[model samples]
Target: METVTTRTVEYPADGLTMVGHLALPAGTGRRPAVLIGPEGTGLNDFQRRRADALAELGYVALAFDLHGGRWFTDPQEMLERCLPLIADPERLRGIGHAALEVLRAQPRTDPGRIAAIGYGTGGAVVLELGRAAADLKAIGTVNALTTGRPGEAANIRCPVWAGVGSEDPIMSAAQRDAFTAELQDAGVDWRLTVYGGARHAFHHPPVDQSVVPGVAHHPRHARRAWHDVLALLAECLPVAAG
Candidate 1:
């Protein structure tokens, strides 16, 4: 197995000191980089492990924070903060841009070859970044099917892949339709996968704390979504083989 190094990186985002988990693959040569955005609950071990896994695959990965080092165990509290943030495109773009800058600054990262993969609110942030015309090779989101402002998706310069549970009330069929319609109308290269019978946050593991309604873990679909993300990255921002 390749040796992966991990560290905590603190950066400013949304007026908070966002502490992100940065993972670097072995060797000194620059590699394709990926930004991992955490769910609305905030950055935690799950996302850190994902960054390490990506590093093991030879891509520099940074699991960026949303709650500035705090994890919300209360679903209502999480919604109180995240709902407004997700609704504001500019705020989401600011957070994504800050994390992207942090990732690009790393010596191991090939700035020109970078992708963003986000979960839930994090997914929404990366989508907003794409809408804002940030230079990204690919954008992948799970459980977040947010539509951008009028015609702003035309600014997206790369392919986008989205995964969501069919039973997810938050990202319902109608919402998915609107999101896809926006992307299609903008002529962006995009794809959406609906996992049958899964609920919102199916990609997330079960938490000890109380979770929002309609959120559940589907291990099978979670694994499938991860594989889909890997495939998308392989196709769009492949790291050079050693």
Candidate 2:
């Protein structure tokens, strides 16, 4: 097994030096990598654990901080924090590219086989990358692909897999149908897995959702969602564009 190494990196974005962690799998060969987009709140325990899990699978994983600061003052404050960036897909795409560049530049990472996975806003970030960042191989998005990207939609050349809870309040039924339709029009190979009886943020087990509405957690779906992330990465990044 490769020894895991974690280090802090300063990413220039959004008007500040955003902090991120680089989890590298031991040994020097070029390894597949994934840039993890943080949830609406920011980088949290769940994101870090996911990074560690990816490293254990022999991939260089970067858990990036899209939101300002290390932590949030409150969840409602999330509106003020992420609304601007989220509303504008272009900024989100720039953040994704910056993070991708950071990860791809790492000595241990395989730049040619890079992919991205993000939760909440982060999920949207990765999905947009799949559409806008032609260089990205695969995209894993969970419960965060809300808005539509018009021109960017038709350009995503890589495989896309989205995870959504059947009961997720954030994702409307119409939105799902439209998303699928867009993928078809673009000729992008994509899959949508809707977890029955699950809610939003299903992958974050220990999250405290006191402030969040209709966003509950289901362990079964979370487990399956995490497992599928690995399988998707393996399939897409391995044959991804170099």
Candidate 3:
């Protein structure tokens, strides 16, 4: 494994002080970067570890925060905070842009070669960035097949990949259809993977904290989803070989 250095960074976003975890690879020189968005519950250990893992793979990664560095354990509290944010594209774009700026300002980041990946509400924010026509090499999301305003997806310049559980009630078949339709009509390259028998947040590890109904972790699917996201990065925003 490569030597990875990590740190906590604070930035302003959504009228709050956002704290993010940044992970850097061992080698010198600018490297392709990735912005990681956490679930609606906020930036927790799981997401920080994800940034570290990406750094180990030789990419500059920043796991950006939502909820202003606060992690909500209660499902209702999380929904109350995230639901409206998700519904508002401009707010989501503001959060994504703020995090992107922080990631780009890093000394080790190759700003021109960047990708955005997020989970749940965080994933929705990543999509909003695409809709806003941010300079992203690729976009990937898990359990967040959110549909943006009509004609906004035409601004997306890179391919998009999304993963969802087949049994997720929150993201139903109709919702998935709508999301895909928008992407297709916008002429964007897109792919969707449905993990059979899984529920919402299947990529997340099982937690002791309270969660909404139908939210469960599937270890096998989680590993597969990670592999898929890595493949997407390798193809779209690969770090240059030393």
Candidate 4:
């Protein structure tokens, strides 16, 4: 395996100190960057490993934080925190913008060419960031077919690709329809893919304990979603030669 550099960073967000993992590809020059968001439980090893994997593919990646660097193994705790955050778009935007600033400030990142991808609640945060009119090359989200404030999606300037499990109760048919409708109304380029026979949190690996009902891992679908996100990034945020 090619060596990649990794670091832990602390930043402020939503009146809390957030900690994230930053990964840089093994190279000598600046590269395209990606900001990663985690599920409702907050940033964990899974997201950090994703940043490391993206770095290996030549992109500077930062796995942004949520919940002030805490990971909730309890479903109730996760829900208590995430539900309110999701309902408040401004709070989500604050967290997303804080992470974006951290990613852009990295010496190895090509600030002008950056993308955002997130899972679950984190996915919603990226959408909120897009709605806030943040400049980004692309936005890819999984299991987060969330609708933002009315007419706010028009602020999104980049192509968006979202994925969800067909059986995901959290991202139901109505939610998907609303999400697509918002994008269409906003004139934003977007795509949605539903993985059959999967459930909510299908992109995640098996956990030691279940954090949410109806959330189960599907290895095949997880792999497919990762490839799809990578394809979205390649299409919209290709790394330039240094």
Candidate 5:
């Protein structure tokens, strides 16, 4: 396995001093990079490990922070913060752009060859970034089949892939239809994958027990989704083996 190095980085976002985790592959040359976004609860070990895994695959990865440096173990608190943030596209864009700037400024990142992937609320943030038309190779989201503002999705310049559980209440069939319609009307290349019998946050491991009602972990689907996301990245970014 390729050696990976990681560090905690502090940046500004959402009127708070956001703390993020940056992971780099072995070597000093520029490489394709990814900006990772976490679930509503904020950036935790799972997201950090994802970044590390991406780095091991020769991509410079950064798991961006959502709620400053603090993670919410309480479901209510997470919802309180995430609900408002998700409702405000400008706020989501602000948070995402801050993290994107951080990733682009990195010495190891090929700024023009970057992708954005997010889970849950973080997923919405990455989608907002795409709607804002950030220069990206690709965009991927899980558990966040959010619709963009009218005609705003037309700004997206790259392909987008979204994964969600069939049983997720938050991303129901109607929501998925709206999301797809927006992408379609924008003429953006986008695809959606619905994992059968999986619920919201199905990609997450069963760690924090205090989760919102409708959240469940499906280990098999989680692994499958990870593989699919990796495939998306490989197709769009194509980092060389270390």
Candidate 6:
């Protein structure tokens, strides 16, 4: 069977019934899977498509919802709800670990071999997993990461990748430079790929946001980011024989 199935998974955490979509490859035998963190907007279509794509590749994929299905395009309100999680770095780590746990419950999933991929704000959450020391094989982050917190990149024992655009407004050269320096100082086995001229959320194939005159687009970088993700995932989550 080529089809993957999904359901609203309710987990007990943080005083809410956190809902998520779990996608598993049909007729699989212990496939390696991952916990895919959604972009700034909760469990949006982009993430669901990505999870489905992973299933087509014969891997189980679960896209976790940190926002509990609530979202806003207004930058201010978005900041309001999302700010606190990042504010307390320790709490963010807990949330990351919690999402990983849900990924482990898939029947066809190989708990021993799983990774994480986070986008935008979700990228920061995945980064915190390193601080909390989640037992993950690998981790990938796509743009919008912070480096100010203490022990942000310390003792990360997994193969990690940080992908961002050179022209991204949020992750400026100076900020990303500092983030990379911390990663190196912590002795992490990681790869930092910077796309020449892509904006903050360039990975999404179709975005209808009003361009703010300054940020530019680079489809080449967007494509390369996807390739890099697959390459990293292959390196992180190995396939097994039936």
- Name the regions of candidate 3 deviating beyond 4 angstroms: 209-211
Tens digit of per-residue lDDT, candidate 2, span 54-96: 8877889999888644666477787687888878888888878
Clashes of 1: 0
Give the true-structure RMSD of model 3. 1.4
lDDT of 4 by residue, 108-130 (tens): 88898999999999999999999
Error of 3 at 28 (Å): 1.9
Estimate, for each residue in 80-115, the C-alpha lDDT of model 1 and write its tens digit: 989999889999999999999999999998888899
Stretches of model 4 off by over 4 angstroms after superposition: 209-211, 240-242
- List the candidate 2 regions with Cα displacement exceeding 4 Å: 238-242
Model 3, residue pairs in steric clash: none
How many clashing residue pairs are found in candidate 6? 0
Off by over 4 Å in 6: 206-208, 211-218
* Candidate 4 residue-wise lDDT at 157: 93
lDDT of each candidate versus the true structure: 0.94, 0.81, 0.94, 0.93, 0.93, 0.76
TM-score of 3: 0.97
Residues 1-242 of candidate 5 have per-residue lDDT tens digits of: 44899999999999999999999999889999999999998999989999999999999999999998989888888889999999999999999999999999999999889999999999999999999989999999999998878889999999999999999998999999999999998999998999999999999998666446778899999999999999999998899632
Question: Which 10 consecutive residues of model 1 have the lowest summed lDDT?
Answer: 208-217
Candidate 3 vs 6: which has more TM-score: 3
Evaluate model 1: give its lDDT: 0.94
lDDT of 6 by residue, 3-93 (tens): 7877777775555566777887888488888788877656777788888888878788888887766756655676677778777777667
> Which pairs, if any, clash in model 2?
118-123
Per-model RMSD to reference: 1.3, 2.1, 1.4, 1.4, 1.5, 2.1
